[model samples]
Each structure stands twice: as C-alpha cells, then as structure tokens.
Target: MKKLIFLLLAFLAACTSTETKKATSGSAVIINETVVASAMERIKTSQPGVDQTLLEKGIRHAASLWREEDGNPSDFIEFVKANYISDPVRRKEIFTKISNYMESVNGHFNDITLDLKKNLDEAAGEIDQIDQMYGNYSVGSHLSDDFFSNKIAFAIALNFPYYPLAEKEKLGPGWSREEWAMARLGDLFVSRVPANLNQALNTALGNCDMYIAEYNICMGKLRNEEGKQLFPDDMVLLSHWNLRDELKANYANKENGIEKQEMIATVMERIINQDIPEVVINDPDYEWYPFSNKVMQNGKAIEAAREPDTRYDLIVKTFRAMKDIDPYNPEMNTAMMRKFSWEMEISQEE
Candidate 1:
C-alpha cells in the first residue's frame, strides 16, 4: 500500500515536471565560436592587465544572452569594445554608481509592490475573491524585460560575471565588502525569465497564498464521530499552520490530547487529499465530522462537493512557469536547484 502511494506521488511529480519542460523549451540566439574568439582578441589587445580568462568568460556569458532584438554581431562587437573598462579604478567607480542606483531602484520597487497589494497582505479586512484575484497580479513582473531591453542587464553581465555558490562559499571569507557586493550583483543576471512567465509564477503563488490565508476552520462547526463537540464555539483556526500549531499546543492536554491531535490530523489529511467538502471550507454555515467525512446543514444531512485539486494544480502551474524560464539560465538550470542550493542555502538531501 505504501509502495502504491509512493508510485502515485511519483507519477504526479513526473506529470508536473513534463508540463514545466514543455512551457520552457525554445530556440534562442547562439553566440558562435568566431564571435567569441574575435571578442577575446579585441579585449586582450585593448585591455592589457585585465585577466584574460575572466574576460573570455564574461564576454561569452554576455554574448549568450544577446538576441537579434538587441542587435546583430557587429553591433554587439562594437558595444563590447566601447563599454569594456580595463582600468581597475574606473571599474570600481562604475560598480559604486551601479550599487547606489540599484539600492534606490530596489527601495522604490518594493514600495510600489507593497502599496499595490497592501489590502490583500494585511490581516484587517474581509477580502473577497475579487480582491484576491487582483492581489495575484504583479506590478513588477516586467522589470527584467525592461532591464534587458535597456541594455543595463547586459552591462552588468559584461562587468560582474557570476560565480557559483560553491566558489563563493570557498572564497567569500577572504573577500572585502565591496568584492562581496560585486559577487551579489553578478548573481542577479544569472537567470532570465520572460515577463509573461514571471506574471504566471506570481499569479500561481498569490492564489496559493490567498487560499491558505483565508482557509479558516470554524472550530465551533467541528464534531467527533459520536457528535461530541471538540472545541469552543467561537474559536477558529487557520489551515494548515495555525491548525497545526493548535494541535501542537494540545500536547499539554493530558486528558484528551491524543484524541484531539488525531482529530486535527484527520482534518489536515482531508484537506491535503482534497476530499474535504467545499461547503465546510471557510464557511460556518455547516457542521462537519471529519473522521466520518460527513457534513450537515441546519440540523439535517446535506450533500457537498469535494474541494477541487486546487493546491496541487497551483503547484503544477508554478512548476510550469518556473520551467518556462529554465532555458535562459545556464548555471542554475532548474528552479529546484536554484531554490534549494542557492536561495535557501540548503542542500537537496537535507
């Protein structure tokens, strides 16, 4: 039975992975060998003391991102020649300028996003479905597109080439603050997700968050199989975090702690399995017996539809959206790797 369940879970995972691959795969501009060689030669002659290997890697990385939309090969060559700064002093000055500007940009974008979604984010008011939908809409989804279009992203890529996490962990201790900042700057352009994909991801995550936030279980409406009231009439618990925490708190209830814990676990299982009735969710209009998986309205038995696989479907959508952006990133190719190893700084096995 456990093997069967594992296989079922694996099958679902595979389905989402396939969907993500389909969404992300595409043809992109290839910077050929000739272009790389020419650029390398140009940089070496023009900028003598600059590290040759770093120059090669930086130019290649920048070239990989360049599209026909940006310009033809000759135009790309000219831009590289014009923009490549050899003098260490001048390069540091440019980094300082970029760092200052980026701080301002980051601050303003954060303020804008917070302002746009303040109502939905706050715990104060009764947010309807419409508000949830609007909150899902991202105001800063197109920032990457704008940056790439304006050649600012290309400039950053050309100057501060990214180093992998492993490299950083090994070398970071010896690095100065400014050097560390430059490494972080390099990290920004390592991946490119199109504006549409960004919007889709933001929407999926927003929906999931809103659903979880509003999934309040009216503790008053819950009953055991024998029709015994388990919780106080006015007490409510949000699923699944608050509910889980409440269950944890029940550990000190030495008399009925195990029974209460079992009951909450059953409710959580019902929710995760998507077998919980729709009417019981966030609705105090119905009484529910989770163990029996039954519902009642107005002291009479009533039928209700099972909640749709909304949580699972949202996971799939998020995966697909992330997968769409996979091609643009070479180093951190998959979303899972990027999230685990890079963002969370947690190893996969752990």
Candidate 2:
C-alpha cells in the first residue's frame, strides 16, 4: 500500500506538470474581461510607467458594452479580431455586411419603442383602453420595460464565415421550427457593421440583445443577472476557463476614469491651489473629486480642429467659457465658414 501510494503521487505530479507546460505553451490571453485585467497589470508593473491612457478609454467602452450585454468574452474577442482580416477588399466586404445587419436591428428596435410608447400614451388618455394595456398596476410600462430587456439589448452573435453551400441549403426557407432559426440567422447575415466594428456596435446600439444572449448561452458565459436583464437565453458551454480578475480590474479603472473625470480634475485643482479651505476639498481621504478635464477647455487644442464649423460648434457649446478664455480673438469668418460647410456638405451628395 505504501509503494502504490508513492507511485500514484509521482504520476499525479507528472500529469500536473505536463498540464502547466501545455497551458504556457499554447494558451492565448484575451477577453473583454482579460483586456481590462491585463491592462491594469501592465500599468502596475511598468518599469517606467507606460502610457495606459488609450487602454483605459478602450476598456471603459468595453466594460459598458460587456456589462450591459451577454456573450462569451472569447467569442466577442474572436469576432473583433476576425473581422479585422488583413486583406483590404475582404475587410471592406465583411464590414459592410455587418453594417447593414446593425441597421436592420436598429430600425426594428426603434419601431418597437415608438409603437409601445404610443400604445401606453393612448391607454393613459382612455380608461376603456386603459383596461386593455394598463389593467395591472403599471403593467403597461412594465411591458415596455420587458420589451427593452428582451429586444433593445445588443446581440452581436454573428455567422459570417461562410459554411458550405450544402450546409446553407440544409436551412431551407419554410414555416417550420428549424426554418425559424434559419430566418433569424438570415438576419445575422444582413446586419453587417459598415467599414469597421466600432461602427457596427454603434449601429447595433439599440438592438441585437437576442443575438448577444444566444452567444452567451452557447459559450456558457451568461451572467445570473445584469443590465435591465437585457440578455436572457439558452447557451451551451464548449470549454472551461474564465476571464481573469486582473483583466476585469483593468476595465474597472477605465469605468472609474470615464464617469469621474471631473472629480479627478477638481482634485488636481485643489492640490495646485493649496488653500486651507480647499484642503478639505483636496483631502485625498475623501473621494477626492476634482473638476473633470471635461469642463476644462483647452484653448490651443480647440483652435486646432482645422475646420470652421468644428470650431464654431465648440465655441457655441462652450461660448460662455471660451469667450472668457480668448476675449481678444477676433470674430471668425462665420459666413464663409458656413458657405464652406454647405459646399462641403453638398459635395458629399455625389
């Protein structure tokens, strides 16, 4: 028994060692969660403090999209990378396809939102119709809320790498159950993100929850609850291994920076001012919120957009603030710039 136990321990040690070797040799580190975690690690360990600013911005957007949707981080990462194929022509083709797909989903979502709002409005004005839609206390609004949960969420599961023609034909057009899935998949083909994926995500902004939910279900990455419960659907898990905490931490910093930029700026101001009263505000002990850089306009930077209308719009938005900053600046060629804008806008009609 002692001899057998010694042999078994040796066997287990060898197997564990082999597994670790295989992982280090073959694994690729990637994910929405992983991106955040890895980014934070790089920032933390930088020998000379690498600029993590871009990573932060990208991760913030990723977190918003990730938190509000459902799908495997792996699948999403795959989709993002694959669509960025090197061949320019092929890249354009894939992007255009994704763009149209997004348009279809967006249009559908908009129509649904408008129709529901109208129905609720009518019900509110009429007690008779109220029974039809508003019978249960605020059930009418609840129905709309449920619709958002179901329909308005982003569903980005795609099926774009062409399967064989035979496989395509297996999905024959019909009024059968399998055909229903085929029809839904057909919409997937139609919703292409134009030119690039960021645009596609923008286009799919208000729709595609079903696709996102379905992808999560397939990858077994579904969260128990999130968003407005925007994504809820059946999914299958193909493999095991989860997004690392370090990655998620990267995105967490991103989230904090984006929503709290003003606060960060205000802290910097107080630290610079060094006044006793401001010290209370500056106390890093409290959630030291400095006025964010969002409000602090850059005079030189604003002047550098190289287009009058762009400058005009900036001036218009921060007119009160900009006026104070550059009081000596002469009036811009408002008429010529507007003409230049009109002509440039008209040129696009071609």
Candidate 3:
C-alpha cells in the first residue's frame, strides 16, 4: 500500500506548472538574487517587529520557489504581505482548517477508488484487460496542477515553509502536533513534477501491480524430488507476499516445514532474479520443481525459456522513473529515502 501511494505522490513534485524555474537555488534566476534581496528588505521594512527572522526566512524560501506564473517581485512581495500569517494562533487556525479539508478530500478519494475498482482489486469477478487498466488509473494526478494554479500552493509555501529531513530530525522531538502538521504542509510544494511524467509513473505502477496480481504460484502443482505435491489441490499463493507469508506459516510443521519454506524461498529468488520459466507462472498446466529447476507438463519434461526479466525490469523502471524526480526534491532525493524518512516518519538509521 505504501509502495502504491509513493508511486502516486513521489512523482507529484515533478509535475509542476509550466511557469519554468526562475529563482531555484541552482538556476540563473530571472528574478535575480538582487531582486529577491530587495523584496525581503521591503517586507522587513514594511512589517516591523513581526518576527523579523521568520519573515526573512519565509520571504527568501517563497522567493526560491516562486515562478513566472506566481507573478513578478512586486506581486510576490504583496502576496507575502497578504498571506503570511504572523500570529501563531491565526496561523494554527488556518493550518487546522486546511488539514481538515485535506483529510476529507483524501478520505473521499480513497473510498471512491476502492469502490470503483472493487471487481479488479477485490478479485470478485472476471476482470478483463480493460477493467484492469481502468482500475489502475490515478484519480489524484491533477491535484498539484489545480492547487498551484489557484495560488493555494504559494499560500502554503509562503506561510509553512519546508524543513529538510535533517532539520526535522534535530527539531522534531520537541515540536507539537500542529507544528508537525505545518512541517508536513511544507512538504507538499518543495518541488514540482510535470503532469505528463506523473501519468507515465502511474501507468508504469499500474502495469506492475497488474502483473503482480496475475502472478500466482499454483501450490498444488509444485512437486519435490519424489514428484509428490506438498500442498492441497485448491491452494494458490500470489507472488510474492502471499507466497512469502505461506513460507513463514510452515514454521510449525517441522516435518516438511523447512523443505517447503526452502522451496518457496527458491521460487521467490527465481522470480526476483528473473529466472522463473515463462510457461509455469500462473499456469497450472505445468508442475514446477524448484529444487531440480525443471518444469513438467502432462508428466513430461519440456523445454521452456526463462522469463524476460519482467519482474526485475519493472523494479528498475520504478526506480528510474522515481530517480528522475531526485533533482527536484533537494531534501529526500531518493524515493526509498523519502518513503522511509519523510512519508513513514522513520529515519534511515532507525
């Protein structure tokens, strides 16, 4: 589930508006350093005694992310003045409202997906290729586009600026829930991923998920050295989670437990390594012997080539597509790091 969610949102930062990078840290800024410095000075001069340090930080941070679509320096300054909530109480109130709205939207979208794709997702009925494709389609791909177009993204960035993982780690322990929520809100607009790339990512992930869904190991057709079936006729395990879980479940049956576990492990390794034969996967027509590395059909040994590294290829595809967004996300560049440290709130060391 986390993997699926990451597939959806991790690419979101890459799908920003076509406003182009103006004041990004690396790029030669259209809104140059001088322009930004002047804007900050103006804000500071205009709003005296308004947490000068925070005001400076917010202005600079927002300027760094500001694009051509977000308006010029004067417009940026005015937006900063209007939207930057100075009072902690008022800021918290706004954050709470936004948080509640976000929760509601997310919850409803989740429910809609679950309900709409019940046939394909829940394994309830015969789902064709079309059904599968439709089920895997993303619902929230355009969310970033909409938010940024409406200046909601700018508003959030101006008020609750982002903190990198390192900073969060150092300061997070003492932070209240609202402060943490503010940090999370800051997390959204850190980078903008193009919508097309996000669509590609969604398509790639959806295909991988569909492949996994159809990848079932017929347990009853699995044979050992003596050509004896170890599992019940109706038993089937989906790769690789269910198959792995079945392997773990055999621990109590000491008689053949280790052997069964070893066989399942071997199957998993073959799948992961892309050595599993194309004919035996999800097809009960062929009985497979993991130990002997053979496939038998109609009780006769037949030659079949190994799978074309589709499983491993998808993993690579996912990583490559995700890695494309690393440059955009300065804090948690890699998707794995983002998943663990940012989204799951678990540090790498932990």
Could you tell which candidate, 2 or 3, scores higher by TM-score? 3
TM-score for each predicted model, relative to the true structure: 0.89, 0.21, 0.85
lDDT of each: 0.81, 0.31, 0.76
The number of the candidate with the highest TM-score is 1
Instruction: Report the number of the highest-lDDT candidate.
Output: 1
Q: 1 or 2, which is superior by TM-score?
A: 1
TM for candidate 3 is 0.85
What's every prediction's RMSD, in angstroms? 2.8, 29.8, 6.0
Off by over 4 Å in 2: 1-64, 67-83, 86-88, 119-350
> Model 2 TM-score?
0.21
Instruction: In angstroms, give how far residue 56 of model 1 lies from its true place.
Output: 2.6
Per-residue lDDT tens digits of candidate 2, residues 283-304? 1211111232111122121211
lDDT per residue for candidate 1 within 1-76, as digits (tens), equals: 5897688557755555543464444326656779878887888788788877668767877887787778888778
Better of 1 and 3 by lDDT: 1
Candidate 2: C-alpha RMSD to true structure equals 29.8
